[model samples]
Target chain A: MAADRVTLSDVAREAGVSLATASRAINGSADRSVRPELVERVTAAAARLRYSPDATAQAMARGRTTTLGLLVHDIADPYFSAIAAAVVASAETAGLQVSLATTQNDPAREVQLVDLMRRQRARAVVIAGGRSAGSSTEDLAGQLAALRAQGVGVAAIGQPVPGVPSVAVDNLGGSASLARALLALGYRTFALLTGPRQRTTAQERCRGFSDALGAGGGVVIARSETPFTWEGGHAGMLRLIDDGSLHGVDAVVATNDVMALGALAAARERGLRVPEDVALTGFGGISTLRDVVPALTTVAVPMGELGERAVRLALTAEGDVVESVGCDVVVRASTPDLRRR
Target chain B: MAADRVTLSDVAREAGVSLATASRAINGSADRSVRPELVERVTAAAARLRYSPDATAQAMARGRTTTLGLLVHDIADPYFSAIAAAVVASAETAGLQVSLATTQNDPAREVQLVDLMRRQRARAVVIAGGRSAGSSTEDLAGQLAALRAQGVGVAAIGQPVPGVPSVAVDNLGGSASLARALLALGYRTFALLTGPRQRTTAQERCRGFSDALGAGGGVVIARSETPFTWEGGHAGMLRLIDDGSLHGVDAVVATNDVMALGALAAARERGLRVPEDVALTGFGGISTLRDVVPALTTVAVPMGELGERAVRLALTAEGDVVESVGCDVVVRASTPDLRRR
Candidate 1:
């Protein structure tokens, strides 16, 4: 079937040129030995024959694919979806296609994807979200070096990978701000729900919040390590409630919004009201959670901008430079004003 | 710096073979002209030199990219994201990569993306949203034909384009069922907040719901065309409320979930309670909306499975086939049993 179709040789025959000369002219080779009239004649013949050069061949000669690779923890997560959307938009404006991969927070998978992107010779690669503490970063660094050796640009969003440009949210600063605001509200005792200990974002947030509360001489009544999901938060909150330790804890500090959402569901199931029965504070200002009544008091990160900035940095910036983006502490109705009381 | 790197010629020299034979062996070409011992020698030499061929050159020789192209309306929209996640998962299992593009509901952009995918020689192309009613399908048909000429596979998720295989949700059937359920609840008058008329999904959904309601001797009190977004729904609902046109309307039926979310916000702004003040129903069973109290009554479509099935159909199916996936009508607190009253 392919034999029946018009080929580049046919175009060369029609254009009355040698195969080598026709190939050089039609492929737009920078050799300059092919005359202008010959290039035009070959191009017109190829157009008349409706011939397109093999894309892979075109890419090989050009040393880069007109593609960018995006590695996200999970595209199903609203946080990551928002970032993915931004990356797509930016890539579109740059006339580049985006190939996405979900690592499921697996370090090995992330390393494998980076290697794959290197083999594809993508124009750039963006790694979104935090890295796991348990993973071997040394291997990833080696893979990244290989990509750089092949001239593929690399940038990371959220995680600070060594030798890679990055745009990370100030997780520590944001959580500390939230803690101070809660302390100002006269919430002296709190129950904390954190994500997996291996997640750097969770660890940083936990340390920041605990540090700030300790500075204020506030008490952390109880703490639980939850998965970075609603179910994890719900289960942790349930455990805390069942342990009969809810006598005087004034608030629940959830490390992330999904966990906070789960905490809300757990509290509701136990016939407790937010802010009134027990105040709640969450990290990660996800837009989906913004509509909930008694809007969650959380630190809002510019997720879309994070993706856009990462792409921009990857495509233009040089060498292992890292850029940190700030976060805002949004005090919503979930934690009411204790000053009035 | 690149000049210092080892080239394939160096490997050929180390292997003691002619350039052509070494190239064929190292690229794993099926020509079978190179001797077996010579192939092994070339392979070993290439491995020792750590030589990786330029990816583009390799792709050109192979005649296809190990990637699929996915065109969606908006990646940030949870509906598309859910499907994208599923598509990525299935593609990974199949050992294929997915390159994504967002058309932003523009017909010209969609055409451009399809052409781009064709130029890239993607394994398959999936269009995951509605085609605009305003655009001429003739141009799109031509593009699809060109893709077919190149041996590229094509499939669509929501809209049905001529000569393209598709996996579509039963929008008409699902909306009709939702209409029946609402009528059974004894809601007499209704207001509809619909997406842009250019969108086929919105059009089909509107036709189905209105047709079913009209059949039951019910009236559609007011209808407004809005953008397919929460903001659009909110503005449309606000207009309806301000017009004092919802006087006897018992419910607002939105074409999709995002609009319903907007309507919820608009109603709350007017101090109107859901179910008690005015009932609401939405199509597209979004899990994010499930967490809301007075859980949204909607038609549950298997979003993730829709994507997986579309990919499977694209890769395996022959001819212009259209498969309709069924949807289920879910009853929740948003639409109560008003028949008893």
Candidate 2:
């Protein structure tokens, strides 16, 4: 049954044309000057044989695939989903397909998926989310160079890879602004919930927030290392509550919005009034957070734009290797103005 | 620059082997009985030439691509993202890569994407969400038949296309159960916020709830047709409130969770206490919905499992055309038991 499958070569044979001529006639290469009659003959033969141009065969014949590979940290996370959606939309508009892979923040898995994308000869590989510090940058750079050597475009959203262009969110600047805003609201003592220790994004955000707080002479009463997930924030907040570490904390600042949501749930479970007993803020102004009472005061990074800009960066690559986007500190009811107190 | 790409023919010439032998060795085909030393020579030469096996060429020789195509309504929607995440995980486990596309509920775009997948030779095509009634079923059937004839697997999640295997959700049964639960809680009046009226899933769910309510002699004061989005639900609820239709309504049931969250926000904005001033419920038990205060009372659909099951059904085809999964009506703090009223 497999032997009966139609191939481009079969189409060429049926059309009584050379493989190269049939390919050029079908694919309509810019450099090829094929006769109209030959193009018509090939098209008619393909129609009669019900020959569909297999993307893989075309990729082999012409050194490019219509597909792009998108590697995200986790798709189930709304933040990444928003970006993934934008990436898919941008790819579609550019007449390209997306092959999505999830790394679950695993450095080894990220490297493996990149190799797979290379093998598949995707037009570009878009890495969404922050790169893990655990992965050796030299190895990743070498792999990327090989892809570029093959004429494949490489771009990242949030993640920074040497020699590869990226659309990066200003995490440090955004978090620093959040710290300033919170301090202005009279949150002097704080507890911070950080994602995986190895994540450079989390580290940068933590450092920026810490620096701003230090400048204001505000103490970080407690720090918790948690997964970059809601459950992590929930569990971490519960542990903080149990440990009495939040005893005098004026506010809780989570590295991401999802974790902040978990912390809010924990505070609610313990009957803590938001903005009254404790103020809470998060990074990543996710859409769903809009409906949460005392809306999450967060760093509004344009998640969708990140995906779009990443694809744009890949498709229209100039000499620029990095494009940085700014984020805003959106204050909502989640954090109250301490000046009133 | 284009001529510089190393081809299989070049690798074969360098290795002193026939092109066919090099291909078989590289593809690891079972039919060929090539000598081990020849295979080693071909592999080393290919490596020395920096020759990565072109996946497209391999697909032409092997009759299929290892990539699966997943078409969803919208990936940004949490419901779809959950399903997508599951599908990607399952495909990875099965040693398949996934190519994702979004129709944004556009039927014409769906057909166009399906054709693109056909051209790309996706191993299987999984269409998530309900099919648009506007598209001719026969036309879709013909497309599926062609895919199957080409030896590609076809499975749909929640969408029922004739002759295509599907993993369907029990939307009607679940909605009926939700109505019964609500009725038992002593709510005599209700309002419904349904997705676009043309959506079959929305129509079926609305019908089920309406039928159950009619059977109980309960009254639905109003019904609003809205987009399947949070803002839609919010605007719908506000309209219902402004029209005084919800003046005496005991509860509002949204067709999906995101919308319900919107309705919850609308009620909060109006100074209504959930379950005290009014009750609220939503369908599609999305995980993020858990963080909402007064945990949403919803029908739990294993969205991720649906995606996984669809892929499994496509992979292990045993002539079964449809697999129906049940949903549970989870009672939470959002909807108070009216029996005590």
DockQ values for all predictions? 0.60, 0.64
Please, what are the lDDT tens digits per residue for candidate 2 over residues B1-341? 24687888999999999999999888866455689999999999999998878776677667678988999989989999999999999999999999999988777777788888888878898889876565555576678767777778888898577788889999899999999888888888998998889888899889999999989878888888888888989899888887888888899999999889988888888877887888899999998677787788999999988989999987776453888989999999998877776
All predictions: root-mean-square deviation over Cα?
Answer: 2.2, 2.5
Docking quality level of the chain pair in candidate 1: medium
Q: Give every candidate's TM-score on chain A.
A: 0.93, 0.91
Tell me the tens digit of each residue's lDDT in model 1 across B73-180. 899898999999999998888788999999887778889889888878788888898776644566776787678666788888987777888898999999999998
| Model 1 chain B weakest 10-residue run by lDDT | B54-63
Residues A209-245 of candidate 1 have per-residue lDDT tens digits of 8999899988888889999998998999888888976
Docking class of 2: medium
Reference interface contacts recovered per candidate: 0.61, 0.73
- Highest DockQ against the true fold, candidate: 2
